[model samples]
Target: MTTTNKNIENIIETNMMGYASYVLLDRCLPSIEDGMKPVHRRILYSMYLQKAFNLTKSANVAGQIMAIHPHGSTYSTMVGMVQKDRHSIPLLVGKGNFGMYTSRDLMPAADRYSEVKLSDIAIDMMKNFDKNVVDFVDNYDGTIKIPEVLPVKFPAVLVYAPSGIGVGFSSSILPFNLAELCDGITNYLRTGEKTILVPDFATGGYIVKDEAVFQRINEEGFGTVRIRGKAEIVGNKILIKEIPYSTTREAIIDKVVALNKSKKLQEVTNIKDLTGLRGMCISITARKNTNMDELLEKLYKFTPLESTVSANMNMLVDGLPKVLGVWQTIDRWLVWRRESISRGLTYDIQKMTDKLHVLRGLEKVLVNIDKAIDVIRHSPEESIDFNLQAEFGIDEFQAKEVSNMKLRNINESYITKKIKDIDQLEQTIELYKEILKDESKLNELVIKGLEETKESFSVDRRSEIIELTQVKPVKLVEEVQDYNVTLHLTKEGYAYKFKGDQEPMLKPGDKVIKVFETTNKAEVLIFGSDRVAHKVEVKDIDDTRVTSLGTYLPNMIRDKKIDIVSYSVLDKKHKILVAVYSNNRIAKINLEAYEGSRKILKNSYCLKQDLVDLITLQEDTKLKIVTDKSKLTVHTKDFNLTNGRNATGVYASPARILKKVEVA
Candidate 1:
């Protein structure tokens, strides 16, 4: 039993390891040299073969390679993904719907209808495929051969960013502009100078490019760039022209709608999805008299209008998955390119050397032509090599070439052509030798290739980079939405905000102390026994007619057994707050002294003692205070308007129990 258990464990471990390897190599991660997943490389190669056969249907491309690929994924979708502009450069140039950035309804067309071909970029990258620059491996069933990695002459990783979810890790390398990449590479090669690569998505927007983020991505293989949408305010509507990378118009609209529904964002009245064939165009309709700037900033905060794109550059290196930074990946790709070019050069040199040998043998034959012809004609076909070897001192390879030539072609013109070709082939071989001997020549060759590619196929930068400080939230004047909600707070500490059509609920001893209407975003002050006034947003409290919404009290009020005395939405009309305590101490304080505190209950800005009563006053209003001994009437002019915020007022009648203060 123990042996069986051990065997099972061993089998499970081996299978899991194999699965992880497959996921990282063949499925999830891409090669550092070729910058292609195994499947993508196969798909592109199949498409490459169809270039001469004219454009192939997307379905055929997928169908041809689907057998060798292990995944059960939809192949047409994969083709569309590679062919999509992605708001960035695509590997395959395609004609038809390949999806869009801003909406769900725009999916790629069916594989049967769509046509695709390898882009000039892909063609340039897959240069010298027939040469021995790359290695080929057997298919999944071992029936056919395929290149292990596409011999990409350029770095496909940056031209088209790679993203995948693999076992234990994933990769997200952000896209860079083709023209910028070409220029950067050229500049670096000419002068050992480096330029920061800011991610440029095809969907133009603003990127909060931080030097540190780029540095981290170059060193740590991971960092994030903040992207924000572009918008303008015209009259009452805010029109969004471009949104953040990977965010759709529908996504931004959904977020705005959610925020509005939850009362978190109240200024936006309607969201319009005006996206069309041109590009992303979303119009946000805001309420009249609304602070458009503030609302636009809120849209950035509360919606996908502002988002981050993370770059985690994990790629397969020599069949093993490894994390590589931006510069490291590029440098490694250069190394690979140079090596592939050198191999190609070596392959050429070797071929020319063989051709030169065969031509030289024929050169010997061009002389003493009659003797060679007599030896060949008289000798049997089986003994041709022996006869040639005996006649001239040429080896088996040269003799084989001589025997294989057609009898009719062995004439004066053929001899002249062979002699000319021999001279040219020898000169070409010598040139290849010189290039192979010098490293600088190879560098020049690589740089030339890059310059040619840039000239032919490089694309312009799409996304823009701005200073990080630009998108940081700024405080602006805010005028809340027009839909005002009425809030009712009782003396017994119950509070509820209701629409005009709703009724307020009350229990015994719950006397309504304050009734005021304000926007849902506006806050109302609550006075409690702690000698402090706390604030609660009209929207923060439950807006309902059914239940007694939970009391909007400070954390300390219930623990300290203090009843909420009053609620007031203090505005410009109310100035002084007169407080009458049970100890017969009454204080009149300026209402303007109250700071906008967020606490549910903070210390009152005016009152310093326990409250028996409180009243907000205007310039002409008179406060009538009734105490145990007498009633005192203090006119607004008589009150000290310049009193401190926490001052306890002088007694209405010294040494008398205070009762209440009211407008007189």
Candidate 2:
């Protein structure tokens, strides 16, 4: 039994290791040779096999992919190939919605609803499919053969900037401008001098220029760089033309909305995400007398107007994961290209040499056409090749070609036409052999290819680089100017605010309950019957400027059913919250106990039955609790409420079920 258990343990360990290696090598990470993960390579290979070069349903392409890679998410990965906004050089040309970087909705249409075909660059990469350059391997079930890695002519890894996550490793090689990359590579090959490289995202933004960060990334394989959105003060408004990479334009708008709600962005009047089909364009209208500089700073500080993009540059090198920087990665690519081209040249030379031999033998046959025809006509088919070889002093292969020809085509004109090209073909074969032997000649060829690729595929850099510098922090609104105001709320949940002794907006049963004086930056705590305590900024309430009809607290809370039981301006002196349940019981907690990033406090105070009312009690505050039979008056001044957390309180009347509460 112990031996069996040990064998089971060994099997489990082997299987687990195999799974990890598969994920790290074949599944998650891209190979450095072709800059393609296994699934991506399989999809393109399947498309090539199926002749899916024309516009066809994406589902059809996906169905073709499933013959080799039935990974259940072929459609998703295939859709990503056509997301022009996400990839610098999209691999596929999709006819339907492939999603954009500006919009929050990233999901594409179903595969059956979209049409797709391989992009020009993808077709170019596979142009040498039949060439003996790249290795081919049996696919998942050994049903079909596919290229192990594509014989890519250009630096696909740098152009595509593929990113992935795997077991204990990840890769994030940011994209660069193809033209600049080609130039840099050619310069390095010629001069052996390295050039500093930076990322240029398809979603255009400003990358902060940090020489050290970029140097580390190019030299050491990892670094972080900050990308800032482009925003400028245009008249009274700020126009944002571009945003950081990896963050949607809608995300910045949402952050600004949240900041404005919390009163941190009170100066931003109208925030509109006007990002259209052209590019990212977000417009922000600032109020008059607003500190424009400070508003812009706040936008950057509080939102994803600026974000970080990290480059890890981890990838598979020969079925093993390794971290490679720009210099080393390009160097490896150059090596692969040289070897592949040499292999291609060698393959070409052998075929051309054999064709030259066959042409020469045919030339010899036409020299004595009548004798060749007599040898073929008289001799048996098995002995014809040997007879021609014996008579013409030629080998079996060349003689076989001479004997297999049609009698009419074995005439002078057709034979001469075929043999006339032997001179040019021999010259080409010699040139291929020379190129294979000469290293500089091979490099020159590679450079020529790079130049051609640049002319064909390179484009203008999308992201601009800016010098990194410390930015001045935006001053708080309260620090700029403190507007002292007195907050008032009626028993019917109407809220009002005023600076001086203006008569409060009043109606029947709506007596004004004045709270302590505070600034516009102050907060008001509103206790709802739903047992939630919501903290609203005093400026947000003051902006309403409600009158006798009043800003209804329930309307502000956005829930008409949550009747406001009690509300008070939160000052340091008033530090206790007393919650009254329907059981005539009272519990107290300090107002500071609810301080957090979130505004609403739910289920924090008591887990008892219904929370009939919540009261933010101050010194000298008296409450009259009314029951079915009699009224119980309790002065909160006598209650010791200076505690940080919830505290138990005695029942005012054990027999009474408290129905309502009012200030006495």
Candidate 3:
């Protein structure tokens, strides 16, 4: 054993594969101080050691970190400490189905299918580590596994830094929300000034835009802190909403489609198909009209959803490297959890005050057990050397302990009130182990024990105690009677109506239209057209138009007629005189009609020779005929048919020409 590199500078350097690659890169890093890592600080110290911190399941924090870190990587450290962009860790509040980081095929599903609790601000930072602040270790062999005390007592705002180098050292301190990081650390502790704001991360978004590179990585330990997100716009689409610190959801949907193809986001048109194990959504959409606040201030000024984060301070302690801050890494884990709770409460109050001083001397040896049972029922032959010379003044080999003594009904005022209650529990455990060795005297004895238990209050306070004063009920607004109906269109369409009460002669839809007694106004025509306001509801109505030749005669005969004629082509057999021919010697004479009178004398000599044909009138020049019941009367006169039906055959006469027909 002397060959362990001859006490390699007095041991403590087994970089067991660099502390298992720094505990698997601090379980995929987060937590310079509060960013959380090491499997989200071992599933929040295994849900505060199985009190189940509001337990939702994960087999109750995976069977309590498999009985306190039994090491076999309990389901990849509860799927990277319940994922969902790891919400930049602040004690990882609660809710459920965390799992995200853009799809590595979304793995997180087990904790009895998501729902592990502890987030009334993570159970008030686990009751501020029950006042001891933090310290508990040993998970590798020497079993007392985990509790190296991290009961997180609030006032945390670490931004990052802690170092190491020989393949070691890294820590990035994170935690933030002590009343909004104490209003940005009380404006950088009262104007040592530091603001380019961003901070809001319970995993929501927006952090980017160089605030002088995270204020020179919070004043020089290292750099980077960008982070931006929360784009939203939903309807025309933008989306993203959140993601940064340790990204994931498939690298935040492949960095939001490579920042919409390097900022060409003509409203991102597609980069969706997500997957980091059932976690996705980077959608996008709006290819136009997309100023969702100038695209979330250009995605917080040029993309990564928002990022930068870095702060490489490094860590290593006794082996070298050190560059810490953010309240010196929470005052070096509150001075190693106040010296490991003052050496485990002074070795558990000196091992229960030395077992109450050996049960107070076994209550005086059971009050002498009735004079050693009457000297052992009368001296069984000198009763073992006279009961060891009268109760242990020792003789006869200590009287063989009084024949194998077994009388143990211990009482004596219950072992003298358990040795005065173990000396008042070792002075109340060394007065809370000397107020956990001073972090401003344990934050001034926890603000004087919460102001003496909040000055003995009432009304069951704790809904997370935020009542800054109390009056919240002034809501009496009911004066909305400006029923809004004002219409006034009088370019001759007339309308004036009003009626909140009886001025009822206004007849459009009768709830009163066209009633404007000088602006108690109501000229409601609602929309167009006119009559008594055709689709009536008239008020101040001169929406004019009333020349009705039956509604403006089909719009003024489709705007002024233009040679209006219908159809005319008269020529049909001119000898057809059926009657009524006034001023042409045939006043009302149908004379019992005829049709074949030599085709009505060849269509009346083609309309009496103003003809286009049939001018054969020689044999027809002096022809006259008449017949009334076949009694004929004829005369060789100018062609004429007189006195009866069919007029005995072909005499015809029908001419009245005034020709001028050439309308092609």
Candidate 4:
């Protein structure tokens, strides 16, 4: 025998694909036909089979379900959590502490402590099991059979939404009101109109209906919705009556305490949770100076009072995972339902046909009572059935039934009852046949069942949908008014601003090299030794006392040992400027090109060894240079404006060292 090694990538791919298929099909995703995963379906089926619809111990139910589901702990928790949920029509009615939706920490007691029973709604999902409406496959041990999917009479997916995380995909479907779901199905069937659905959470909250995402969800079956806890400010406290769907009383209190400790919730002084499993009630006391509205907004910003619910309409379609739109899901469900109902009717018709055969055989016996008695009394028991079949033109099954018939069944009154039963059975057979043949009749039956289910399980929508107004963003810094201001810079590298107009108070060694008049709204540019230009907004420079030293130049420009060579106030009307470097290079460029914020302005330019001076200039303007050795002059048109700030310019002067450059 020869042994071969498989490629590592191929092995990994095969393993991962198998794992994903298991997670998607058996664990996470629900069947669209029944809206239940295998575990949930098994739990319900076990209860139905055991006739444990009364208050059966949850542990016993779990034990029964383990025959089908191997993992006891996980299914126990799932059963406890799902049964206690008050939002949709619960599949199981549970007693005792079945945990809660508000707090994940408060887990329900061990399954032995909790009692559970199936609800009427859950029974309806398996209504036609005995009638052969759905297919069943062998159980895990092959000891028994289990349904592949329930023959659900109505749409359970929309009413009781699913949320699960899987291998590569997950789903978070929101529950809707039962009445609305029924109406939607009816309307969709009647006029081919798609019904719009909104989330109706059991833990009542407010939904921002005007959000564009909600509209997209209704149209495409995937989007996000914003939910806020119901809150009101009264007196000195804000009372939250209900929190978001996933939020809990304990969690909300913890969040508030954490926010308060961090000072993020400035107005909140104390927090308390008076919530129970029934509903939410949280009270937060505010400080004396708190603005109630702003306090609530802060809470919403920092706490779980507001949250988002995502919609991902992923389910099993034809035994494959697929994301469907809203109408597409409804349409597919209707088709499945039509087929199931049709199969059920066919099963019923066959049953009636079988009964009519037996009745007709009995009718023959009634016509010839004496011959029937002789055939039954004198004929050998083994041959009696064959004799009866031949004599009465009946099949083997009917003949066997006659041979085994009791004496009471042969009386006159019993025969009359058989005749009436045959007539009724014949009528029932015709009705079932008609229902199967006509499509509209089938649709009407579906509509009727949906309406009846809605009546049995419908409740007022707990979540309120409202068009929330978009809140404007608040600015962190206040706006400043424009006013006349004077800027002064010294050769010693001191920069200051004065209100109105004032002369710089310079020390004996210091000299005021540049003084400019600009408004508070103006942006002042500083040329540095590092071949970079820095900008400062005039409003940021506070007015200084005449006797005090000005703000250090390094603090303003972010460079040390660098004196201000020249400074200019950017003007909207004048976009051109000229720069002269100590290396005797001169360039003409747009002033707007150098415009940047205080931090970013440093990298805006490149220079030679040092910067000589920069001046605001206009197009077609001429420039002059006064050098240490000599003077050189040229027209601005001698060179073109360079687009890049780092570009070294053409020489404006022949002198090796230039002292100053100015407009001629």
Candidate 5:
């Protein structure tokens, strides 16, 4: 049958959605209950089955787990190998060249070269799998069954927080200290209150712990966590001990090299990667008279040594994907623990009942030793099970156990041992029943389990959380030394800076139109024909060759093609004076009105045409204009000071043929 286009469209949409949901729920997001994605869960389960607690070849483990993990390619196997290194709290302990943790681009040795095994933590994560604490599902081929999730007793997720992008969702959970996470979990269990948890990186670093910022981030379950590399100044060297998470030593060194090459960090004389077995050490030697504090701040601003980690607690909850907060995650774990304990007890009680039934049958056979022997000696293997079930009134499983029993001359000691086993089984069953029935007892068991894991696996905090004041950006001017300089702008649009006493040699067409003296730290505003004010720092001008032509004003602001008509050094001690269009209009205003920290502005003087000249107003300020008709106009009091830059002023004279403007 032919399908309609609309029907085809619906099928496509349905299939895409199904695929996306599968990737999101099963493949990408980790379960909030166990803190494991599907592949990670399978690898651990396969390891447990192999009894790989002692060191074994990673290739051997990976080969065994491939039956359960569908996407168990070589790359995935290697990723699993590296993830279990010392960096990730080492759930799977690795031996022999697991690759460089400081450099992510480097690949680990082939699986044949590396050895791995379950750590105490990994063993803890899979402790109760055999006891029916977690659900099991059929493998890809449906021949074998594997666990749906691990019965992780500890806060495994927090200890090794996840980071990955998934279909229609993503996750980036920053790892926290094992001890602190246990404390947080304990606090939540007792009080049902959320606790603030900061990320702790394996690479020791400094975290900018702004409590208010983290409070909002944790409450929202998604935000950025600020972290900075650990650095200190000793003698002439700045030593970087540890870098931010996810940044490699090579990347940081490359960034510093680039910054130094650009002269943005010119104080550095040399850089050395003195990284040794102790830890990451980058020694940056400063030039003489360099400010070490400023260098450190600049490195933090420009290098990967400082970074922000995005925290998104997106994970699987009850087979569905969801984003959860810290307390919500803990509560889900609590619910899972309760269910697991109940199921485990039920599983235990069933096993004990089966064992006691078989033991009781065995005890009866020993008592009727002669009759059992006669029947077993004559009856076939198949008829023995039938005969024992008929005579003893036991179930098929009990009869089978009796038939399979070794003769050993039917001793009395064996019967006595069976009876003792029955008594012990009964006592254990009662204890398990009490644990399942008593809520307090269950809670105590959970807490005890958590404490045991903590005692075994807790490590010292690697990242230090410290209170930081608001980060006011360091001003470049504060780092620069101040000196007096003379700025010269020529009619040909060339800008120059020279020593206050030196005179620059001008080219044939070059004529200095504007000249001003200001400190090198001051800002000079250059008004262009486009009515835009472009700011240039005095120190930015080249002082190497005083006689050479400086930067072109038009090139400074690339988007606009403009000629420098007039310019003025912005100083707060004076008033701004401007002459518009050949001194035909002039105005004076306080400098404070237009003063801003911006480097570019439009329509600075509100001119209808273009600016002619500019200066600072003094008590004896004067202006002279020469008209094209050879007429001259002198004005001082005609144009009064205006508050607004946009306000138009009266023409200095009626001579419409305005020529040139000069300030005297």
Candidate 6:
């Protein structure tokens, strides 16, 4: 055997041992391809059957899956199947609590509460059943029952993954939508090459850089694909708007920090804290001005902010492994789908036709009941024998009976006329089958038949095909009343005092102020000898009582010489006699009296009473002098005499001598 053949055999053996298998060719045995072990696959198959065929409940679908798949089926699995129908496959119809892609915590609802229906897209794809585009498998008990091939209609989208083992290869293909898969296939078909930037599953982010890589994978089964993401720049700062698939938020943050510390991204001041982050929005501020484009390029080249996905088109088929290109996978799937539909349709059509035949025969048998009754009544001795023979098509014995017995008008002969209607019914059944061969033609025939029969199809038929258009509600912005207490200054930078239970702590920037009342009344002096008596009035005191004296005065004095003298009348009245002091000496004596009834105060020393009283003198007085004597001095000075008479220098030779003498 060739080396390749030997390798194939070993791969097959490895697969049988529950290990990875490597196949030399792309095709594998039908049994192996159809026999997938994963619970996810089984669930998906169950949903496809139910949704595509319009089954009503998850429990029902689960029951069917339990019959074929080796794994024990449960309500949860059924729920997951229903979700996979809606999310993994685009054709899935029906609604209720499918899991969320944004988070992994969402588990599908239990089967009991959930309902199932086929989507229009799904129903259309169900046509593949007629085309025999899928394969079927036997039940767990070896009953020929469940479908082995997935019946996907062409131009239809199926987002599903298949898992299996081979000698040296094993793989898990993640789910992808129909549109993207079609785009990938179309690209590959045109250029003999295609590459799909790997999609981020949990986050649903995308990175598309080069189409050629995806195209190459599509055509050649393996290629390296490059994907770049959006990098936004505000001046010197770089902000990454998105990241490539599979790059976690933590991973992105770590990469950024590492790059900054390593000096790969120079002048990065610091990495900010990321907490309670649902999605990442990083801001990379530069300490100094830098070329933004150049920095972004550096980030792409040096950081995990960008990454690549390797497209490997290697999958298991029929227990064998094959490396397939993008086009190859699509093409293979297309062929498989076509064949499965053909076989399924052939089986279903033949079954329906056979049922129609049975019904026709039953109608004929019913019509012959009168003949049967006549034969029994007339030939009671041979009734059992005649009945058996006639029903089993025994002509010889029936002919003898027909000739001898006088046939009653409503007897055996009458039954024969009614039985003749079976031929016409059979003809109608044949016409219906011919029409059903083409769906559009069948639809037309159905409409015409409805008019003729004046009967509507079942409600189930109406739900089979629907026109889908999603209408989203338009959101209107609502005006909300916002209440806020804002501090306003009166051009003096003084805000209204905010009262609190205790005196509020005051700071320079604090916008609130607190005021407290002084315990003692502020005294106003009217005249030196007369004390002004005034009552304090407090107003607008918050959270504190205003006493009659404005506040509680603990250390207030009414008089120095006389203690509460003649304190009268509850209305703060007083009469007192005290000596007025000036310079610590009694300047005058006064009698002061306050009368609350007259609202008047009298002082005997008041200036208005008498000017002489205001000019009163003290009993003892002394003058004090202040002088700097040490710095002063008195001196006597004499103007002394002497001006001596001098000689004349004029006149003579005498003159010279005289002149000289005079000059001297």
Summarize candidate 5's per-residue lDDT along 1-664 as a digit string, tens digits.
9855668788899999999988887777888778887777788888899999899988888888888887755434445435532354776777876666666565687888888888888888887677888879999899789988888777566667775677678887667788888887777667777789877888778998777657755676677888898999998789999888868788988988876776566667788888756766899998666778877887888789888877788878878877777667777778888888789889989999888887888777766767777777899877998897777777788878767778873557876676678889888888989998987778777887888878988888888886667664764224666777777778776777777677777778789877777777777777777777787676666673665767666665544566667777775444556555654565665555566645677767766644555665543356667776665646556667676765566677777656666765
lDDT sort, best first: 2, 4, 5, 1, 3, 6
Model 6, which residues run further than 4 Å from truth? Answer: 1-37, 45-147, 154-158, 161-167, 172-177, 180-211, 231-241, 267-291, 362-664
lDDT per residue for candidate 2 within 375-480, as digits (tens), equals 8899987899999999998999998888787778988899999999999998999899899999899999889889988898777998999875778866535463
lDDT string for model 4 (542-575, tens) is 7778887777666655466665666667755456
Q: How close is each model in CA RMSD to the real structure?
A: 15.1, 9.1, 30.9, 15.7, 13.6, 30.0
Instruction: Itemize residue pairs with steric clashes in candidate 1.
Output: 87-202, 532-604, 534-601, 587-649
Model 5 local distance difference test score: 0.74
TM-score for each candidate, following the candidate numbering: 0.70, 0.74, 0.27, 0.69, 0.68, 0.42
| Candidate whose lDDT is highest | 2
Q: Positional deviation of 272 in candidate 6, in angstroms?
A: 6.8
Give candidate 5's error at residue 442 in angstroms.
2.0
Residue 437 of candidate 1: its Cα lDDT? 84
Query: Candidate 4 versus the native: TM-score?
Result: 0.69
RMSD score of candidate 3 (Å): 30.9
> What's the distance in Å from true for residue 96, model 2?
1.0
Q: How close is candidate 2 to the true structure, as a TM-score?
A: 0.74
What is the model-wide C-alpha lDDT for candidate 1?
Answer: 0.73
**Per-residue CA lDDT of candidate 6, range 1-664, in tens?**
6544458788777777652221322222122222233344455555565553654776676676675565565555444334432233433444666553322354566666566655554344334444444655665588635555444433221143343344455543433444445545445445556455232232233444345654665567666544454567887777665555434445656776776655455445555433223544567776554555666666666665666656544554544466666456666654453344335445666665554454343344345656655555676664655553566454443434433444353354554564465566566556555654654443343233223222221111100111224423221111222221111112111222222233333334533211222211111111223432321111211222222112221112233232111111111111112221221211222112322222223332323221111111112222221122211111111111112111111111111111000000
Where does candidate 5 clash, by residue pair?
none
lDDT of each: 0.73, 0.79, 0.41, 0.77, 0.74, 0.40
